[model samples]
Target: MRRFYSYLIYKLYTWALNGSGYNTPIFNVIVTLACVHSFQLIFLMFIAFKCLPANTHLSGWLNYVAILAILFLISHYYVFYNKERWEGYVKEFENETPKQSLKGKIYVLSYLIGSTIGVIWLMYFMSVYLFK
Candidate 1:
């Protein structure tokens, strides 16, 4: 079981990082989203079996997980194949825009705040489910 799980995880990591294109925002975004999608699946599956055991037999959850997996795979492949176009687009945008460190800092701060909220919400729900 441990070997199977490890092999599955290895395949997933290979899939997530299998782009042939150079490092760019498009590649980074797709990989990051794929990782987030993978994390979400792990979280939900753990919750389903450990917390909400009643829904363990439902096919809908499997369907939902499949959809998410497909979505991320498509997104990653799309970006990987069209990397040149994406790079050109990014270059054009960057050439037209001026650097604004303050704005960039603010955006980073906002993202951190949103991520904190999401983590807190997940913890709260997990606590409720596990304790109740």
Candidate 2:
């Protein structure tokens, strides 16, 4: 079960990161929205809430938090550790004849802008929500 779950997560991450149509404007939007930090934050939040204790002052949540954190790291490590496989998928799915048109450039530019915003937001979220 754990192996299956890990495999599923890895595949999902690869798909989100290297979308089926990565060069397409819509797919780029999806990739921008599905950034790693966003998903990590969501998962950690869910685990924290689910493991929160009834006695608000209790520190029991720490154990669960730590365990979940390890699992989270493991899942991400698995995905990234298999970088060669992911790159192969990207190479396979990427456009055979790379787009050189103005529209293609615009799409790439939009993706870069959107990705920048997403990274900034993730940093802010970590500092504000996770740290303090």
Candidate closest to the true structure, highest TM-score? 1
Model 2 residue runs over 4 Å out of place are 1-39, 42-58, 96-132
Show how many residue pairs clash in every candidate, following the order shown.
Answer: 0, 0
What is candidate 1's CA lDDT for residue 51? 60
Scored by CA lDDT, what does every candidate get? 0.52, 0.50
lDDT of 1 by residue, 67-112 (tens): 8778867875664455455444334334322355345435544544
Tell me the lDDT of candidate 2.
0.50
Clashing pairs in 1: none
- The digit string of per-residue lDDT tens for model 2 on 1-132 reads 544333333334444555555554333333433454455565456545545665764468678767865676556444445435545544543453444334544554554465566556765676668755
